[model samples]
Each structure stands twice: as C-alpha cells, then as structure tokens.
Target chain A: MAGGYVGKILKVDLTTKNVSTEPIDEGVAKKYLGGKGYAVYLLYQYIKEYELKGLSPKDIDPLGPENVLIFATGPGTGVPRFPSPGRYHVMALKAPLTGSIGSGNAGGKWGTSLKNSGFDGIVLEGVSDTPVYLAIVDGKAEIRDAGDLWGRNIFDTTRVLTSVVGGKNTSVTCIGPAGENLVPMAVIMNDEHRAAGRAGLGAIMGSKKLKAIVVSGDQKVSVANPEEFKDVADRCLDALKKNPVTGEGLPTYGTAVLVNIINNVGALPYKNWQTGVNPDAESISGETLSEKYLIRKNMCWACTIGCGRVTNVKSGPFQILASEGPEYESIWALGSSTGVKDLDAVVKANHYCDELGLDTISSGSTIAAAMELNEKGYIPEEDLQGLDLKFGNASAMVEAVWRTAYKVGFGKYLALGSKKLCESYGHAELSMSVKGLEMPAYDPRAVKGIGLNYATSNRGGCHVTGYTIAPEVAGIPEKLDPLATEGKALWVKIFQDFTSTVNSTINCLFDTFALGAKDYGELLSAVTGWDISEDEILKIGERIYNLERVIINRLGFDGKDDTLPTRLLKEPMPEGPAKGQVADLEKMKEEYYKLRGWVNGIPTPGKLRELEIEV
Target chain B: MVMPIVNVSAKILLFATLRDKYGVRELEVKCDGTVRNLLENAAKTLNKGFLARIYDISRNKVREDIIFTINGRNIKDIKGEIGIKDGDRVAIFPPLAGG
Candidate 1:
C-alpha cells in the first residue's frame, strides 16, 4: 500500500455471487503504473494462467464467462492537482469485435467516484445467471438484481439508478439495449453521454448479464507529498492554460473545430474511404456548430480545459433537447463518411447513438459501408425493407441508428459491425476496417504516419492508440510532412509508447498538447513518492505497449494481421491534396517492427526480456 | 520615381479560438510582402490581441504554438522569407487539436 493508490483491487465473480479484495503488489504497480497498463498486465497474467491449465489462448471466447472486464484507474487519477484528472478510468477486455487486446479510456466523475469509494480497480469474472448491477457505496460492494433496468437506454437507466441507488451524487455507468442485444458496437456509457466507446466491452457486460455500476463516496485521495504535488500540478495547469490548443481552441470550440482544418488538408474520410475530401464539410464544420447549435461547453471532473460540447438544434426536423456531443469523430463518421451533409441529421444520429449506448464511430461507419454496398447493388432494396439505403439519405441514416441499436431488420446485419456486415455480403474490402474494428475519422492515405499507427494498433484501427495527427496536422511538438514515410516508424513508436503511459495515467490525451513526458513524470513522482524520471516513465509506456503486443501475438496474430485495409493500400486518393497518394504500409510496417524489437508483429524473446515481460 | 505598390490578396482562414474571436471563418487580407507581413496585416485587421496570441512581442517571431500553413503545407516546410501570392489560402490556427 502506498500514497496515490487506494491499494485494493476488487474481484467479483457473478456466477458464484462472490466478491474478494486483494492488495495490489507494489512491484506490479511500479512496473505497469495503472489503468490500461495494469489492465493489460493483469489480462495477460489471466490468459497465461488459463493456458497453463490447458485452454489454448486462441480458444478463449471473448464473450464467454472466461473473459474478464476490468475497470481500472491510475495513481494520478482523482488527484485534484493533476491536469485533467477528470480522466480517471479505462475499460479493458478481450474485445468481441477485434478479438485481441480491447481497451477504451473515458473521462467523467465515475472514475474519481470509484477510486474514492475505495478501490483502485474492479475485475469482474464469470457470468451471472440473471441480469444484475454492481453498486459500490462507501467502500463496500454488492450485486443487485437489475431485471427492471436491463433493456432501458443509458439515459433512462442512469436516471432510474440514481433514484434507486442514492441521489444526485451517484455516478452510474451502464449499457443500453445495444449491449443487451450483444451488438458489437455497444458502448458502456456513464454520466449519460460519456462512454468507454470502442471494442464492444459493453457487449461483454451484456454477455455477463451485468447492467450498470453505481458508485458514490466521500473519501479523499492522498498524495505522498501534497506540497510537491501541488507545485507540479500548478506548473502543468499553467502550461495547459498557456497552450493555445488546450486553453483557447479546445475550451472554446471543442473537438469539432477540426472539421474544416482536416477537410482543407484533404485528410477527411468521405463516403466509405472512396475520397479524401467532402464538398459539404464546411456545412457541418465546428464553426457552423458553434455559431448555430452550441448551447454551452462541458467538462469532466477536475478538468480546467473544458472541451466537451453540449449542443441543441432547438427547432427543426432534426431538433431535440440539448445533448452532449456529436464530437469531431461522430460528425465525420455520421456526416462525411456517409455523405450526409445535414448537420442536424448528424446531431440527431449522435444523440440516438448516445442514448442507445453505441459507439458512434463503428455504428456510423457501419451504415456508411452499407450505403456503399446498397449503391453498388450488393444490397437490394428488398434487403433494406423498402428503406432507401443511399449515401446522404438523412432519414435512412437516422432510422439506421435506432434499428441498429435494437438489431431490427437490416439493422441486424449492421449490428454485426461493418467488418462482419461487409464480409457477409462478400465485400469485406468495402468495410474500411483493420482487424474487424472500423476505422476512425482520419484518412490513412492522407496521413501516412497515422496509417502506420492504425495498421499496427494493438486495439485495432484506433486513432488515440498513437495520435500522429498532433505532429502531422496540428504541428504540436514539431511538424512532420504527412506524406513522408521516412522516420515515421520511429515517430509512431514514440507516440504509441508515450500514449500508453498517458492512458495508464488515465488522464485526458489532450493534456499532451501542452505538457511533455517530463511533466507527467513529475506529477506521478509527487503522487507516488517514486523519484521517476522522464525517460524512466517513457520506458514504462514502452513496456506496457510491448506487453499488449505480446498478448495479441500470443493469441495468434503476426505480421500478416498488422495491415491496413486493401483499399487504403491499393486505391489512391481520387482528388484533393492527397490525390494519387496511397499508404506505404509495407515500408512503414517493416521499420515499425524493427523499431519495436518485434519479429513480424510478435515481440522477440530478447525484447520481452528487455521489457521484463514474461512469455 | 516612386509608384505605389499594389498589395496581393490572400484568403486567411482561422480555426477554433481564432475563428470565434474574429467572428468569421475566412477573410481576404491584402499584403504585398512576406508571410510575416501578411500576418502583421491580419493582426491589424483582426486587432492586436489576436496578433499577441500568435506572435511573440519580445522575440519578434511567430509564436511556436501558432500553426501557420499555406495551401495545406506548414510554413516551416516552405522555408525562408515566406511570400504570399494572390488567391493563396493561408490557414492560421492556434495549436488546434482533435482525434
């Protein structure tokens, strides 16, 4: 037990209705830090233990009782002094979609509440015979029947749980109908809208018959040296305020500001990756949103840089009450990718996704793939059940969101996600995914470094895994030629390693725009009483990354799996600044593997030994 | 012997905070000199507060945090006394970021 961490890990077995607590080893904490780092290490340990008992690693079902769902927090989480301490939790499991290392990071009061309620992390194993919800109140845990809450949308579930559990202070994270139906795009949403939205961890929750987790407590998180921690925290805060991206750009316009910028560079993915530019990009741009619909800005707990947007289309065909996002990714996924320029329709779709507990990126991208298929005559009008499934068909897009959540009609196929849906129709190439998970907003061909990051990402097709866009587009730290392949492998390695550490800290990734690796090291050192240096902290990030790589490799992935979609490699950008350019994935993959000390995509024995990872 | 020189017109696009403050997404700025001169002209047009955010008063250099791009290329890549041509799209952002 040490300062910063609550020092207790809770393990709940729903099948046995048993709960146990254990002291997290200090050695393990120092090595993996926490959040994604701890989750990955613990998951690897679990898988290894299982394999020792004769179950093959590849045979472990992602949705079976064997799969472990982890909700983890880091030492820096819930610390008031830390910049963006609001980001305090990460959800990790064997993703049903990618079937590899699946993880998602989120920000809100939930993580802080969980930590304050007296646990650093909670691990759920085995399946419950009946639907249940876990409630942690003042350091004690209980499993309650969730028969009444099972099929409700996230918003309704949160409201009902808050009333039944306690009061306004109770933070509830729950899955909606999408999760209950085991839709692969399901997201676990908390605070009504914020979600651990990728990898279908929500579906895992569904598979376990678990509904929601509500936590509320008043315990204070202590630091080893409060004075030292405050000083470093202040410096970090000052840096954030002084940085234009964090202090001004983000807080003011939120993430949607990138629409025009990305489109201007011709990096915005449109119409299922057929092109890089969107003619109606400006119509749904952040500027337009701010001018027309933004009601106010929002933030997570302990966050000074408020980048969250609360928007409302007060009166229109797409009108609805004020709601939380339609962030840049959602806008791109539902708008540009689907070739629908109606901002209100996109916002409406975003609202539906949030309410239904779906990952907007996967859901929207899935619809886009279906649109392309329908247009190509792969899907007949009868297949859509009289619904005109065409790109830019706003009505169809809105309806698809609702249907996909409920797995109704053609939506049943959409529920399988783009990769599965496309494969079923014998057009997997049109899916625009890697490792079965749909791609995010960034166009790989336009941004070569990001393309490499996408292909080799442990979680599959994720931008946050290694956001090369900072250097490639925003020029944070330093500007790199987006088209250049030389030295990109080295950059991707650095970014990926650094991001692993950031995710482990459970802090908002936006903090990196202002703070450097040393700043994070100083914050952690003050909180944990460890004299950690910048390079040492970065090494921990590298170790965590390599550990995840080992887990995926052990599960049967190799260099062949580390690849972009065929369209990204074979098809050139048809127009705009990126016209005629394609991702040089092979070249970057070779250099990336070498830099990672990996043979093919698997970590070499020496590399494993160097990182102190046991095979 | 002296004739007045005509200024070149370039479209200046501001994003995020700059856009919010300027009250317009894009504007046409006329400058007959280097990119620095165009920025200075924009500073006068948008107000000095905007310029103070992008330029360092003490160093007399473009603030490192200001991401200045000309026709989708970073100004740093273009090299030397960056000149702006008529109808060229110059995008100036205040360290903008998103996923």
Candidate 2:
C-alpha cells in the first residue's frame, strides 16, 4: 500500500466463524483515501453482490448473519503528520434511529492499537452465539468472554475492561447499559470520552450481542517517504498547533465556548428553536463553568489543540459530583433546548449521557421537543408523570436525561428521537431536525451556511461536516451578514466535499478547520507519497458523498427527500439581528444539487464515471 | 502623527490538559500593527489561533479553558496587549484549572 497506511484488512466471519486477511492495495488507497473511503468501497462491493442476487431471501434480512459492520482506520491514523486522527468509523446496516447507513466516529488510541495489532480494518459478520469482546494484541485476535462486563455502563465497563486488559496502553471502544438494553438512541464509547454517538449503532451492536473491543499494540502506522513526510507533516502539524482555534480557543474552553457567542448572536436554539436565545445561557457558559467548576482541559491523541473540558461541580445540587462537560451542542440541546441553563444541571446531564452511552445532542433535542409539546397543551402533564417539564427547569432537565437513559416515565417517547417523538404527538412540524437527527447550536435564520450543512448532511442534521460560519460569523476568513445567504451554496459545497475527504482519511475534522484543502493535501501527499492534488482529494470527497447518498437512495432517500423541518422553513427568528430571517434552503439545495452534478436527485452517470465509481 | 506598523506576534504553549488542542504545541503570527490592528486586518476568516496567531484557544476568545498571561500576570489581569511586539510570545495557552 501507499504512504500513511497499515496495509491490511481483517475480515471476521461470525456465521462460519472464520477470520480472513485482505491486503490494502495502493491503487485504491491512492484514490479513495482511507477509513470512510474503504468503508464505502467495501459497502459498495457488498451491495453489488446483493444486487446481482436480486433481492433473494437472504438479502432482505439486513439484521441477519449476512450483514456486516466495518470498524475502519485510515491512512493518516496514528501517523505523526496531524495531531487529530480520531476519525475511525463504524459503518453498516440501516440504524434503528434513521435507518440510513450508520456511520459514526469516535477518537482514542483504539484505532492506533488496531493498526499496531496488524490490521488496517475489522469487518465483523454473522452473529456469534456467545457474547464476546475482541481483543487484538499485535495481529492476534481472541474472542474473549465478556460475561461479567456485559451489563455495565460505559464508565464501569471501561474500568472493568481496563482491569481485564491490565494497562493504560489498552484503548477500549464499547457499548454501555443503554446499548445493551437496545435503546434506539444508544451510543458507543471510546477512550472513556470520545464516542460514536449517533444513530443508535450501539443498539445494532447490542442486537449482535457484542460488548467491547479492546486493542493494544506497538505497530507504527507507516508513511510513504519518511523525510518528506516528516518535513511537510511537521510543518502542517506545527501550523495547526500554532492555529488559534486548534491551539488555544478549543483547548481552553472546549466546544462550550459557543454558549456565549451563539447565545450573544441569538443563534443558540432556545426552548426547541421556539426562541432564538436562551435567557439563562450564561449559567452554562464557558465563563461561568470556568469560574465555578473547570478542573482542566484535555485533547485526543496527536491533537495539539485540546478542546475537551474537564470540570468538577463538587457541591452542586445536581447528582454529578464532577465531570468534563456539557459541551456546546449538549449545552444548547440539554441546557437551553430544555430551558435549563444551570451549569450544574448541564454537568449532570452530560455525565449521565456518558454513563448511559447516549448522544447528548439527540437526547437533549428529544427532551426539548417533549417539553414543547407538554407546554403547548398537547401531552398531558400526567404523561410527564408529575414532573413539571418546563423550559429552564434544571432539576427536571437532569431527571429527563436519566429517565430517557433508563427509559422511565416520559422517556420512552423521547428514546424515539425528535422526529418520531413529535410525530407521535401529531406536531411533527415542531421538531427542528432534518431526517431524524436534531439540529446543533447554529440557527439557520442567523447562520445560513450552518443551516445548509445540517439540512444536506448525509447523517441528517450535522455541523461537523461544514463549519463555514466560522468565517461567516466568527470573522475567521471574512465577515458576512449572519442573516444573509449570499454565495452560501457554493461555500457549503466546498466545505462538504473537503470535509468528506478529511473524515474518510480517518483524521480529525478539526485539523482541517484551520486550513483549506490545499494545505491538508500537502500533508497527505507528503505522508502518502501519492500524487494527490487538491482537486483529486476534493473529488474523493465527492465520491464518498455520492456513495453515502447512493446508500441512502438504496435505502430509499432522494432529492424529494432532501427536506428541512416545516418550522425552520416557515418560522422567523423571534429575536436578535435576524428577527425576520429564515434559511433559503430551496436555493441552497438546488445549487448544491447542481454542484454535485446529480440529475434531479439521482447521481448522474457522467459524474460517477468522472470519479471512477462504477455502479 | 504617524501610526506604528509594528510586527505583532504571539505563540501558545500547552500545559496540563490544554496540550491536546494544538496539533503541535506552538504557533507564530505576523500581525500588522496595534492590538486593534490585526483584529481589524488579519485573516479573521481563519480560525482564531490562525488569525490571531498567539490568541489563546479560549472559547469566545474570552472563555475559561484558555488564557494568555503576561509578565507573570494573566492577560485578563492586565492590558492584554492591543497588539504584540515582534518576538513576543504573548504566552497564550490553556489555563490552570485542574487540581
């Protein structure tokens, strides 16, 4: 294989109970990049087989033994070029939540150790009769019994696995109590902090009766040419370390720093987007959190810029003694979305979500939707089971987090995600989400690009793919009216394709936030010794986008399906400089489709050929 | 009266848990003039650390996870420099918040 590669793929067949090794060829790595690319490639190849069979009895049951889950690491992973290589993903059958191709990323030393353990990827198939965890040590795979670790939460599971593996060098990725219980919104955790926290893939794992995958090894991820790789990668890494966002901003405050900025700009979705700003936002802001509870800051491996927060609210009224965050999205979703901006309450919510192994964003947004319905005279107060589920009540908010995890009281409805929860209440318009996933902190009425990303994201509503507002709002590249949608479609397309490329490489998306594709490509070329131009790299991104879209299409989603919530389309901003603004989604969507070279909603044969993707 | 076109620069260091944010552990900037100079002129469209060069990675540029210290005092404790002098590290980095 070419540069920055581990050069092998491990395919384990659970049905026949066989494990096979596949060599990673340079021809594919040079074009597809890594991780997500390989996942797409493998998925496409597998789907092609199903197509040839033409919907046979074996093909219909995706949950059956034939379905596969790929845990993939890319070329740049565990390499010295970029500090953030935590983009490894688990991609497989339709999730119970969105039923889209389940793709979620988590960061830790797990991917690195897996590479060191003599494999670039792991493809698990069939269903094992016994519950077991995969332990890979230097190319050796053992299906170890996880009988005692089966029922534990993420925290306890991590510790128990830690004790079982017996080393800090051991990196663990596991599902928790929520996943084991098969909650539709359950998540998978890595490094005790990082998570594959979307689309209830954990439920899929739980369905398969898998508990944990602990990896540790000393194998180094190899690069094409060491001298050139080190020079360019070192420069780029140094540049990222030197970047204010990567270097200082994120590390010091974590994503929670968005509390003040988004709140100040009236972009924070408050009370479930019914309001623009949170009145009690400051209570959960980085300023207040740092003043009261910040214990320290932390970062992922090879990351020069640390944005993860470590906090302790020892004497707060909340049940949590101390913990990391209430990050920005969670603060918005759990804090302002629920109308409970209490820092202590936010901390408790974060800790419980971590323990339960659930995505706080989806969980919080779901709670907010429920509260909105409750206050709107829809769900009876008794449905809340005597809990006064009002906006801005920290006590009730904290309880909601636990209840949802435990699936108690009013939480069963919330476990269904925002789309289903509101639909059940016959107010589907009230849920401010695309697909089934809820929107993050950015309100499209204020930041148009963020809206575009959320609406068009393959993973439903998401921001990690395109954070264009950093230039548009934060004035990083340039300042534009947050309320305006000028040239937003083109900008969104650039960010999308580029982000898709980076994420596929199995590297951190944040590393590219500071620089453009050219600089990132330089590092890739240096590390891989591949003649990948910026245009080629971007095209790879387009290929991944099309691949994901094709999967969605195969699962039955299309341009007509590319839709925003009725509220975001019809509602005007209630307050702030953008009082009358709403997302110009129709224009952005049309432009996006044109840029992607799709015919109507379907991928054009020409564009597919141009990317060398044969269907 | 003439405005000074002094070179402004700042570099951040990683300590405690803040070290994770940086892909590396340091950065340098060639900001134009005064404190207001780069804030008003540099590539602000870039991320803060890229644009501000030595600006600490604090959320909102004023949040708690990161802060810049000058002359043994926190930048928040002082003028915080409207602009930096050439070769000034500005000592931007993650704050000391852990036990």
The residue-by-residue lDDT of candidate 1 on A349-412, one tens digit each, is 9999999999999999999999999999998667789777799999899999999999898889
The collision pairs in model 1 are none
Please provide, for model 2 over A1-615, each residue's C-alpha lDDT reduced to its tens digit, 9 standing for 90 to 100.
676787888887765667788888777776677787778788777777777878532234435565667888887788864658755878875666776667787776677767777788888877777677877777777777888888788888887877777633578889887777677678888877778877787777776777888877777777777887777767777777777677766776777766755655667788888867777766777756766888888777766767777877777477555566767787778888888867788888888898888888888888888888888998876678877778878888888877777778887767778888888889988887777777777888777877878877777777876777665555555544566676887788787788778877777776765666777677788777877778888888888888777777777667765777877788888776467777778887888888888765678888888878878
TM-score of 1: 0.96
Scoring only the A-chain of each prediction against the true A-chain gives TM-scores of 0.99, 0.96
Which candidate tops DockQ? 1
Candidate achieving the largest lDDT: 1
* Candidate number 2, chain A TM-score: 0.96
State the displacement of the C-alpha of residue A305, model 1, in Å, after optimal TM-score superposition: 0.7
User: What residue runs in model 1 are displaced by over 4 Å at the alpha carbon?
Assistant: A167-169, B1-4, B7-9, B29-63, B79-82
**DockQ score of candidate 2?**
0.04
Query: Residue A588's C-alpha lDDT in candidate 1?
Result: 92
